[model samples]
Target: MRKRSIAAGLLTGVGSFVLATAAQAQASAPDTQSDGGAAANSQSEALTAEAGGDIVVTAQKRAERLQDVPVSITAFTGETLARAQIQSATEIARQAPNFRVSVLGNEDQPKFSIRGVSTSDFNLNTASPTGVFYDEVYVASQALGGSSLFDVERIEVLRGPQGTLFGKNTTGGAVSIITRAPSMAADVGGYLNLQAGNNDYFHADGALDVPLVQDRLGVRVAFTASTSKGWIDNVTGRDLSTISSNALRFSAKYQDDADFTATLRIGRSRSNPTNIGPIVNGFGPGGVSSTGVNPRINPLTGQPLGQRQGAYNVIGEIRAYGDNANLTLTKGLGDLTLTSITSVIKGQFLNTVDVDGTNLDALQINFADHSKEYSQDLRLSSDFSGPFDFTAGLYYFKDIADIDTDYFIAGHSFTLAQSYRQTRTSYAAYADATLEFAEGSTLYGGLRYTSDHGRLKRFEVVPTIALQPTLKYNDAKPSGRIGLRQKFTNDIMAYAQFSRGYRSSGFNGGALNSAADITVARPEFLNSYEAGIKSQLFDRKLTLNLSAFHYDYRDQQFINVVTVTSVGLVNAGRSKIDGLEAEVILRPAAGLSINAGLGLLDARYTQLVLNGVDLSGNRMIEAPKSTVNFGLDYTAPIGNGDIAFHVDGTAIGKVFFSAQNNQDQAGALFDLNARLSYKASAGWSVGLWAKNLTNNSVVTGAVSVDAISQFTTMPFPRRYGLEVGFAF
Candidate 1:
């Protein structure tokens, strides 16, 4: 059935292309550029825009055309993000193939999975296997996870293992966010946008670029402030999903056309959002009550609440705040360019949940944490004209976090408090190079050596629990990549690669029942083999990329639920993942653009034995077997302005939130988005946008408590809004 659906989609795309071609016979060439950013560039922006010139990227720690990189990546330009109203990480995941995000009870923290690799444990101190880097600085804590999409320059999603260049915690893949730099172009330019929508949603974000000294020094300031009454209607009074957040970034850059450049950035963000309680499934392992009905009943219906509506006595809330600073310097010394990047981040997060989702106050949980991180990366890149070119770098990272959690159960009759401090330090060195062996054939490979150290101290549980001794862990691992590439032509390239990815070992921070629960989870490793081709055919009017990958995974980390109230990280014996991905972009006419992506995956555990249970062959959590996305955009000149319309839809296959893969613990999702806008030649625009047009909602993640009930988390329901913007 999935194959048939894919074929039908292709046929539909061809039909649309033929119709677009017929219409172009009577129209002149329309402006194909859809950029609305102050830092706009003339190139193919994203999957939703026309395929035109080259897109420059730094996927390999060096600037190169996207088409030239051998890795599988999906990138979005600032203009494309604005046009699509993609303001959150989950929204971006919806547009990318083979990528998924699961939001836990806390709305701000989202776990990312790429190519069937992910971490399911919701431990605040544990870093995600899929690393996220903001301007080359790694984000080290899940507590600091929030919206960071405003005033961005470009976003790159690299699939498969990127252990060589990215290093550490990237057994899955990497997400790189490159912010727009202060231009030294002797021009004062800026952009402002305002948006209003249903559920009392209001958003305002803008960026201003100022030239302090022409062609030398400049500054850029950007901010985003948004508030919403939220969508989830609560019977108890205030809306359940309300959100209020603000972020600001200030950047200063000094550059000499001769050889030196330095940039400094300081940013801060705060969010206080009222969380909607999870949808309550049927009774958990405890089974139904004597009445044969659910034990937890909804007051309105007198039945178990299986929907998203909330009826909480104590409203679930989260306060997440962060401050970050980064400094980068680059100097050219003959053929070698020396670069340095230093970053520091500080954050505090507090989360409270009405676990039972009832006015009865059966259960509640409070989680709070304070975290700080410091990192430095130094690199030397060569710009040699010779066949052999290389990039080498050294990296150091350290993070410290203090966690405090309180659990209230049985109508607040029993309470538990757990506190711990976790610290991690890592050091690494890596190098990569490419050599043109023959005319158009090249050999590229790199190796990275990493040393990781972890310490957990002052772990204690209140109410006369044992005082846990300080636990320490240290390990050294080597990971790398080797690939071969052939440039058949200027518009086509193919590559094959084998890469090794790694995730550091750490103590489970979620363990609170006893000292025995605080066990170390050994490092997980992956061996991936991949082959792909990239081509621009039909006179650059069509772009297609295809890749196939297989992974031999060992010691896969998974959450082991010992009981309702206790959980820890344990390594599954083994697993395997096979995947195929394809991306197509077509410019059927002057102002018509279409894009489609297909991802097919088969990921499952090959061997597993937990407590005398042979639980092998289970599908990996959030590892959907099939995914598809299609996008269409059309623009036509009307008088002195242009009217553009865009619509896109994504279909995600069924996914399980637990390793057990229960029938009721899985669901699928399909989302549709559309935007209609008019851009005047005077640099002002207005648009109408709608997301989740069908109001589709399904369970994306869930947790089952022993003797309790299953709690599920869902995506935002539906939203439609109007936006006004001006750029100069």
Candidate 2:
């Protein structure tokens, strides 16, 4: 309660201060400077380039300088990622402020939490509030979340509600991954890389770009393949956490002078990994354990016997495959530009797990799912070169999923099999406009109307149980944002905004016992108030950005422990989130760069009643109060090549994985990553990289069984590797 009060006070104070400052700026800059506006834009762009190496982002569905976007965003270019040795998407959380990820049994399925908002339910049918997009097309299922990051262009993490432009499932925020496209202007070129690491890990990837018709047509192909021996030794013969995955992508582009351009991309990936199963944590209510403290321990040390070992009678693994395609078309119509994006994706996933972490097979599960998705986005925007410009778009999305699950407990004495199909559909229309009424001052607002519908076909189970044959959920809402951006000077800018975001309703897809157990949760909504400042100082060598926000959250969808053995989806009556974020980048020397970020959050349930118990004031799960990240990059010439070294780390405060805020399910962890590389003038490079240098195997997620026992999953241990690459 005291923390909430303090956060509230801070929020109120910042809101008042920013409002006053904005008003003062408005009054001082009442007259329009027609000719200076262009120069100011150019100057701002130049400053951004100098400070951040010309980072560009599409946070607002349009290409713009990162510093010029009113929203808070963190962007990483391909070069930066390579230098940091950040391969998978989940690894990015360490460098992003207020961002975190939790794995579900395997590396292929990751749940993202941003700014205290996340999906707690592990059901495959549920969608995350933080939407993940590939080239602007939303991915609805974590089953298909393991997209390869090879040959990428840039990654943008947009904070705050993007409902005005991104539409539904963006109540928290959005992640946009823009991959490299075929360029006709580029000559036939390509690069190849091979890497080897501990744990018998090996990786090879390459990309080739070819111009078919000089300046008119081009094609690009990229491929990546990797395999690794399991780091976790299992007494049951097969090792856990072993990985084997490969992916390939093809891109083609056509351009008709400067009037029209079209690009098409198609990709496919397959992964078959031996996943880490759960470890038993204490006993549940009235649950008697015949096997005391599973996993025979080391009596001398009083710890688990092996450094990285598990006793599993049943091997666990995940087999997943996916295929996707997207096409983007753009046309120039004088001062207006029209664009269309169409995408389709198909995926299949099969998983088997030994849930008890013991050799007895006390609990085990086998699950499989198939997914198909399609999306279309059409938009038009104007480049008036005047004070006014606008963008309008129509978006449509559809997804269908089929699920099959089986559970075995008590040494297979009791077994259950279930199957079901689910579908989701959404449509949205939105418009955003900006007008510079006065010099260095802009007014921007956007509106979006969204309609969402969800359905569950039927619950089919062996040993037939009576339940609802079908279920449906529907909602229509309006979400948008209004903000004022004031450029106090060419290098400094401030903005304040009020926005609303929404998450669609969903049905429970977990184990069911009766008709009453079949349930649907109401849609969740968030109203946000935010203020921020962006600045570049000291001759454009230093960059600093800060923001504060408060959220009025309602009907937050959460997983409820219905019984000792079953769980379902429910809605929290009310909740609140208050946060402040800051990022800094400095180039103090010619050969060095420093970057740092900080995120503070105060999130709690203001009103929540479950099963007649007043559980108010409980801290939200997966939300850490404080997070900090810092890094250093240095480069210097040595002999015939240049040597580069980067080292970064992130410290995350205590995080709760259970809604009850159980201490047993909470922990804090830190991660360190470093890379050293030398590039020669002859188009060749060699590097060494390491991740999780401390080998901190912290529990990232948990599943409770009737509050009697819990199953916890841990992150990968330390990994070190060396790579060789050549360009031609």
Which tens-of-lDDT digit does each residue in 1-728 have in candidate 2? Answer: 56656655654565455444544444443232222122111110112232333465667766676767789899888777778877777788888899988876676788888899987888788889999988888999887775667887778888888889888888889988878887666579989999999999999988999999987889999998889998777766677878788999999988787778788899999988876755555463333333444344432344564646767778767888999999888888887778888999999988888776767767778878999999999988777888988889999999999999888878888877777899999999999988989987899999999999888887766664544467898899999999999877555678899999999999888755665666889999999998887765555566777788889999989887654347778998899998988888988888899999999999998999877878799888889999899999999999898999999998899888767777445577888999999999898999999989989878778766544456677777899999999988
lDDT of 1 by residue, 1-728 (tens): 35434544543465344334433422432333211111112111112222464566677887676777899998888877877888866677867899878887544687889988988887777878899888888998886754558888888899998999999899999988888888756689999999999888999999999999997899999999888885665666676767788899998988787778888899999888886666655563444422233535666777554355766676767888999999988888877888889999999988887666566667788989999999999988887777888889899999999999898977778988889899999999999998888976889999999999999999988863567788999989999999998866565677899999999997887776777888998999999988887766665677777887888999888787655468888898899888888888888799888889888888888888776788799887779998898888899999889999999999989988777787435566789999999999999999999999978887767877554466677677788999999999
Lowest summed lDDT window (length 10), candidate 2: 37-46
Q: Which sections of candidate 1 miss by over 4 Å?
A: 1-53, 284-297, 301-306
RMSD, every candidate, angstroms: 5.5, 4.4
Clashing pairs in 1: 564-706
- Quote the positional error of residue 105 for candidate 1 in Å: 3.0
Which residue runs does candidate 2 get wrong by more than 4 Å?
1-52, 284-303, 562-564
Query: Which window of ten consecutive residues has the lowest lDDT sum in model 1?
Result: 35-44
Candidate 2 residue pairs in clash (backbone atoms < 3 Å): 284-708, 564-706
* Candidate 1 accuracy as lDDT: 0.79
